[model samples]
Target: MIHAYRFYIDGEWVEPCVPKTLEVIDPSTEQPAGTIALGSAADVERAVTAARRAFAFFSRTSKAERIDLLKRIVAILKRRNDELGDIISREMGAPLAMARAEQAGIGATHFEQTIKALETFAFDYMQGSTRILREPIGTIGMITPWNWPINQIACKVAPALATGCTMVLKPSEIAPFNAVIFAEIMDEAGVPKGVFNLVQGDGLTVGVELAGHPDVDMVSFTGSTRAGIAVAQAAAPTVKRVHQELGGKSPNIILRSADFSAAVTAGVRRCFGNSGQTCTAPTRMLVPVERMEQASSIAASEAAVLVVGPPSDPRTDLGPVASSAQFDKIQTLIERGIAEGAELIAGGLGRPPHLDAGYYVRPTVFARVTNQMTIAREEIFGPVLSIIGYQSEDEAIAIANDTPYGLAAYIQGDPEEARALAGRLRAGSVRLNSAAWDSAAPFGGYKQSGNGREYGKFGLHEFTEVKGIVGFLND
Candidate 1:
């Protein structure tokens, strides 16, 4: 078993002020995979102090210097890519193939993209007679979720480094091995001492302390909506900037012009991808009422083919959810879907056949679901899909936008009509005809989904504060 009992602070691996530890479980086997030291407020303070001290020089670093640092980090990450994939699979139940292709790959992608963005990004620009400057915000406190662990970490960390900002990261304790490995990568890449720090702990202690720390200029959080509100509240006293990418119950609208078979199949695959734990998953499928039966059949057929097994299995497409708590939550929601009168069209309640142990949940689908139903309204972080029929195109848009979340929306139909309909979506990211996700595009949400954005130029800008210098140049 792997043992990670030290926190990364000030360029060294040091024991926490308090020696509390948490067992890291492999969700697939329900076995203890590893252990990590649980951090305390004192640990958070140490990390914040280190970041504050580093900001003095790091913030003033030239773009070229920061670029080199990012490049080096990317190189080290590439060398350890496969190792990262295996570690993440064991920690969070992501299939090994997915862990390598997306989990680990996205981390490297962020660093590489940020480096290219920095090459042409203008930090200082002129407007009228005044010069506008975008400077790095100091001492960021980042709290990332267990789902998409490395992806969230890299998106935040890569941009912070690119923008020449110092940060203290508190990766989710449930899935922290990848973060620990990443910190080692930073050390190997020769990141300036104290420029980056890691504290492993739960949100109540370390996360709260990091957000409420007076020295932290900003707090970037990616997790559930409830925790995000708490982070915002804690950081409010210090008036630090809070950037959140919270929960999403995104909608997928299949227009009357679309091919139902293809759309429904693709939607099921996308929804179940990551065991349906993605914050922006298209969980609620809005189909034409006239074709409800047809859509349901396709969705059921598509879900039937998914291979649910241990993450280590080469053929497994769906692994167990991240933890016992998550598994329980998904199971409860699936039961609620049934009790609430939604028709069970596919797999339902309990583990897949032959899976006696582990946190596995059956990939479930509910048909004839209404917007008011619990299954359709709430975010079920599992392989569950709720298909709701809509009377008209206008009704579909209304139903899609009814939720508190506006993280993402999907549309399938003729290109022209889909594009036109996509304009009506309240979501931040709208995918048409199952288009490929663009890493360069700004990603976040509208309304309760959370504020601010990440990825590419938008991500780099999130770590910076704008300053307008009036009359600095002679006119």
Candidate 2:
């Protein structure tokens, strides 16, 4: 049983000043899975105060010291891998295998990657006669989402620790168990008091306080674009550095030079992966207008083959979405697609017939979708795919770039052509032929997908500030 009824602050499990609670639901069964204390502005102040006090000494720790700390943390994390997988699967409804391999394992991966980056990183260097110094930015307020709970937390928290910054994290109330487990890991690793804290609450109180807190030097948030805007607005008064990783309606384009069957199949799988909760999920597919029918057929076959069932079942390929809100939203969008004349190619408007009583959504597909359609324009954030046809390669690029979000895009075709086409697409990252995810490569977005980058050395830099002292080496 996962019991998390208190906040982790100042290296201790403390009760909330205001005793509010939220019952976390297991999406797979639509039942209460866990209960967590809800924090208020008073709670934020306590955590922030702890972080501020710790930053004085923590920020000055030697690089070697921080490295040792991360190593210890990673060791504990690896040992608790299965426990984290179980908690994450229950709280957020990812399949057990995926929760272990992708969700929980990625947390360990982030720390390992940060360790590698810190080993060779130079905090200070000379540019001509000038000495350049990089220092920790200070206490960070981190707001993470339920979709990839620990991945977001690790990316932000690992780098903060590496760069000698302290932090107070406000994990999504929807999936707080994984974060509580993370707090346990930190305590086991002997992390310094106040260097890391976890608070639980809604965006209204905890999130706003974190963003607008005078003591917070930076606020890093990952969620919907709408909520990201609120965070930026709240931070505007404090003038604290704000970094956001928001939503995406990413595009997947299949060039005429590629094999239609292979490209379309891959695109469908990626779109539905993680129950289509990934912000960088390729929700929109651009295919040749003439081959739309064939592409739809291939995509439908792929979607049908995917098994959606209880998260415990090892054979289950797709699990329920995170909550009822997501399920309802997806159903509405699928309904809108049909109403808007977008061809409903496969799977639509309800739970899979085999299993009932959960937040499960069918793996849906829509063809003949234009860029302006509601299903194409909005970020449905479910296992819904929209295939838009293009007349030519130029039209394909135009159609793909029409969205307000450009977090990620995919291209499948001749290698050289795909490489050339990648440059034309307006997105933070582009993959040619479904390349494996690279930890070192920067992950973020372009346009309204939100500002700044994360992962690897780039993430380490986000928690730091640079200063150039002129003529420091004068003789």
- Per-residue lDDT for 298-367 in model 2, tens only? 9999999999999999999999999989888899999999999999878998899998799998999999
How well does candidate 2 score on lDDT at residue 222?
Answer: 98
Whole-model lDDT, model 2: 0.94
Cα displacement (Å) at residue 237, model 1 = 0.5
Tens digits of lDDT, candidate 1, 200-276:
99999999999999999999999999899999999999999999999999899998898879999999999999999
Q: Which ten residues in a row have the lowest lDDT in candidate 2?
A: 1-10
Measured with C-alpha atoms, the lDDT of residue 258 in candidate 1 is 89
TM-scores for the candidates? 0.99, 0.99
Q: Kindly report the root-mean-square deviation of model 1 from the true structure over all alpha carbons.
A: 0.8
Error of 1 at 52 (Å): 0.3
* Model 1 local distance difference test score: 0.93
What number of clashing residue pairs does each candidate have, in the order they appear?
0, 0
